[model samples]
Target: MPTIVVDVMPKAELLDPQGKAVAGALSRTGHAAISSVRIGKRFELTVDGPVDDELRASVQQIADEILSNSVIEDVVNIDFGDAEPAADASTEA
Candidate 1:
């Protein structure tokens, strides 16, 4: 099976109360080195067949139109999931 991953995050200009709360807790727990945190969402779609161009486009549509709110959220990333999901570009070779 193949999988697709979508990452959605609140628009940067808006405040993320949940993320702020988590950051506060982390700071209180001695994670002082971390200054801030922004929480986001992850969606994984497992498919039975090959992940081709058509499927990728479809998933992009789903991410932009269905998985996120245009008023406050943005679809920040898309992963074809050919391998283990990397948290960010820094983790990839």
Candidate 2:
């Protein structure tokens, strides 16, 4: 099976009260290194076979139409499970 991972997060410019509250609680609990937190959603879709262009497009459409809100949220990342880490990417080698 092939899997698609979607991560959606609130826009940076928007204030996330839930995240703020969680951050404050963590700080109060002595986790001083935690400065902030932003809440988000993660969706994983497993298709029957290898992910192709058509599947990718369908997944993208599903993401845009049902998985996230475009008004105040952004799709931060989309990953095909079989993809290898890009050699030149700073986050992954």
- Candidate closest to the true structure, highest lDDT: 1
lDDT of 1 by residue, 1-93 (tens): 887878888989999999999999999999999999999999988987898779877777787779989789877778888674434522212
How many clashes in each candidate? 0, 0
What is the per-residue lDDT of model 2 for residues 1-93, given as tens digits with 9 covering 90 to 100?
767788888989999999999999999999999999999999988789778779877777777768888888877777877656223211211
What's the residue-level lDDT of 20 in candidate 2? Answer: 100
TM-scores, one per candidate: 0.84, 0.85
In TM-score terms, candidate 2 sits at: 0.85
Backbone clashes in candidate 1 total 0
